[model samples]
Target chain A: MTSQHPTPGDARPGGRTARNTAAVLQATLDELGERGYGAITVDSVAARSGVHKATVYRRWGGVDGLVRAALEHSTERHWEPELTGSLYTDLLRLVETVTSGFTEAPEREVSAAAVAAAFESEEVAEALHRFMSDRHRRAAVIVTEAIARGEAPRGTDAEEVIRSAIAPVYYRLLISREPVTADDLRRAASITAAAAAAGTFTGTPGPPTP
Target chain B: MTSQHPTPGDARPGGRTARNTAAVLQATLDELGERGYGAITVDSVAARSGVHKATVYRRWGGVDGLVRAALEHSTERHWEPELTGSLYTDLLRLVETVTSGFTEAPEREVSAAAVAAAFESEEVAEALHRFMSDRHRRAAVIVTEAIARGEAPRGTDAEEVIRSAIAPVYYRLLISREPVTADDLRRAASITAAAAAAGTFTGTPGPPTP
Candidate 1:
């Protein structure tokens, strides 16, 4: 049964509400991984989560809402690279994080399901965009640091650099259906680094506008 | 009824079989563009194409087979860039072709559906892989030409260069849910060209090789 207010036990740090939400979100991801977005439903999620159907409905609204929540949760836990002062190392670390999703089974399943869901649902699309934007903004800090150190041009597009560095790996993963190896990751970073150093990403004018 | 033997007119280019096959494939793409892969069915395709359900079933084997045929047909018409002798011009031509799909409504719809289908179905996945590989191989010729002309390094990974040039645009198109612009196309080409000319994609050892 759905309660109008949170239970008294919901007040604590690992409370009933928190535990239930965790179980529900985890169940949502598991269902997505197993069956993809089209096959998932709130009823199935509730059954798998062991939470009451009414609570699942009342709390998450529906399947789309649950998927958005689960994606947000998953991306919150996703890795961000540690800045190593060198653009190449920072980029390599970032590429490692991104390529790991394609290489590892669990991550790959989740990513594949998310990507599928984005094409199927507007809510998932918005959530995915937000998630990627957040990740890109965080990773772009490396490029910003490089700019400060003169490792990259003053006007280099940080987000573009980060996106370009990882785009080839993802292109292989999602589009071309090719295996993304460590070598591929290294090449992606190296190519992006080379371009960035060459001012390829800089939005500066050509020939001083003469 | 399923016919064990081909009709006399089946062998002719403009005959019944050829016409039916063309109609069916066209209907399949229309269905994919309008409703996407999840909503496609053999019966619907048969009805839409004005072909008998039995004929559709017998000829293509099933929905997957029909989808594969449709995908093959679609890719057959997909544009390949003209060789411009200069790598920059050639890559720009190639990027224009790829980005055109995103900018054009009909092609964008079909592409979005195909991308969505690749995530959802194995048949579409195989077809998409083959299609992209064929296109990539064709586009890589430009990079090979560049290598031969001494415009790029000898070991520059031609396929990688092509993929890298277009990856950002595709990444924004599909993943980021962003609108790709002509500026993005030019930037992709320029950055990839810069990297390729710098020998970043050469599969060579850097200073730390020792």
Candidate 2:
């Protein structure tokens, strides 16, 4: 991979080039924490990474490009899939992982800053969307597996359930300025899981009137 | 209330003044139809309502003031009480009311825009949060009522359930660019409802291990 940017040269398949791309992404995250998306420019990143400016621009083009590459490494390295076989257990695990990584503590400082940046800029928003969607795809795989096992119930509406598990933490972070905790993730996980298992996507399913 | 930027001789006792304030709020909603919040200024609102700039300023210091004033009369004229005593029914009604009001044919444009503006602008976001927290108090009343009725299972985390109900719709509106449909609202209501009703909130209520 081109040290400044991943290109055909890096794509030709050698561990050395792949390692360079990894370093660029690593530096990107480092810079993200030191200087958030709003302040971090391509020039600064290259200087920090000891890479040429051409490498940074040629591969990622701009902030969005660099950040997307950053997410490619950060989200994967930081987040791991958990398969507990039970949909509720699995979802709860997923919720805990997400909160622990992206929402709750030190990670939230970096991740939330990025999400807040998305609100301020359209390009950043798109990059954030792409990154989140990719992560969503991973969660989707787990949900689909649960559905196959009948753990998620019939017509569980996996997408809605997945989104439901997430919304509150982010809501609290950006809107309410409340702290998102392990307890919060647990609560979200519990509600979404129980609903998904019971097939709550059907209707209100309130106690029937006599 | 004080008039724009604080003016002399604007103070009054009650009755007619309260009525005038209400009139101003209605006018604000009407003006919002012609322009979204970004397009709205304290000046435009004063111009539309035919109130003095000082009067508008005296009442609301900034955009937050205008938005708070506007929200007073613009939402559901009245909410149905948490009767029927079923939390699911109560919550379904609440979600449907909010989503329907925004999706309503005539008011949809400005209603949606106003909500969007609440998030997009810093001044408006705080106002909107305070606004939602007030509304959330109303929903909380329903959950408290559920606990009183003992219809909610033991150890139920009602607050989490309620928040989850609204989360997806907000996500759909703000991020996904989707209409908050009756169906979507219902699914959200149902998911939160079914799981909550099951007493899953207390602990490890995952899929069946068998």
Candidate 3:
């Protein structure tokens, strides 16, 4: 959603500018995770990043811009679903990855903080939309691979299947505020996998897999 | 999770006291919806409610107390899922209701705000947990009705079934930031209903629904 490189005419790429940008964005995320979006400020980010306050304001604009950039920067980080041999196990892996992102720390605070920040700011919301959409598309590769393996019928809505397998986990952790058991994860994976095999996702059912 | 009546030794429950409580809580919700959690304050709620600031502080304590109370207040609202005979239609109704709570006016702001507030405050989070749990249990009746009618096998986890049916809708709306179409709703209902009939939710298959 945002370029990793500096905005045109803003600053040159690499060296001191690159180091400063990385430090400032990381500090912004740390602030978000620790104190949440409401407490983040340019001065605090600068102090934490060791980048001058004037440099932060000049480059990132303000807290909103900083958060948006941080989200986009994080999106560019290496992430891929572990493609287990079968669709069910592959989806289980996918959902488990999602659970860890929320349940485990470092990522947990920022993941939740981003979602919470979205409600308060349009800039944050748009950035989150892009971030999540990127994840969905990347994870859809599992379903796509399943189709090639003849586990699911052709023309399946791969992203929809991905959403189905992971949504329950999110609903439990974030909305319902319930603990997601192993059984819960298994059920989600099994349901989505079975539905896909039955051609429920393709919208035109072929013969069900025997 | 909180009592609807006055706290012990706080005040009487009838007439002016009740009126004041309702006004202050409603004002709190209004402030939450309009300005969000960060912007809400006792003074603003007092001004909005036309109750005195000292009274607001004395009763609600602070913004956290006000938000927690408002969430608890909203949970007491009368809500029941539309039972449309079949599990699929029933779930469709449930998800549609969930979508509208985020999309429509009056309730939309409060609904999103409450979920957002839960991330920031433990008090609000617990209140949201209770609120959503109540909704989950109430909506599970559709699955219970299905079991009784032999549409699904006995011993199905009715609440888990409800979670599967509605989770995707929420994922699309809040997490992925996608626009939910009628097709998305239908697909969710169908997948969940089929899974239930297949004995996926029961953890032990007796026989598939004929």
The candidate maximizing lDDT is 3
Span of ten consecutive residues with least summed lDDT in model 3 chain B: B201-210
**Taking the tens digit of each residue's C-alpha lDDT, what string does model 2 give over A9-37?**
45544454566577777777777766676
- Note each model's CA RMSD in angstroms: 4.1, 6.6, 5.5
Tell me the spans in candidate 2 whose CA falls farther than 4 Å from its real position: A1-86, A96-135, A147-150, A153-156, A174-178, A201-210, B1-34, B68-85, B105-124, B148-150, B154-159, B201-210
What residue runs in model 3 are displaced by over 4 Å at the alpha carbon? Answer: A1-14, A204-210, B1-14, B204-210
Question: How do the residues B30-52 of candidate 3 rate in per-residue lDDT, one tens digit apiece?
Answer: 99998888788899999999999
TM-score of 1: 0.90
Angstrom error at residue B118, model 2:
4.9
TM-score of each: 0.90, 0.64, 0.91
Question: Which one is best on DockQ?
Answer: 1
Q: What DockQ, between 0 and 1, does each candidate earn? A: 0.45, 0.21, 0.42
lDDT of 2 by residue, B116-169 (tens): 455445566665566566666557777778777876666666556566677676
Pairs in steric clash, model 3: none
Please state the Cα-based DockQ of model 3 relative to the true two-chain complex: 0.42
The top-ranked prediction according to TM-score is 3
Question: What TM-score should be assigned to candidate 3?
Answer: 0.91
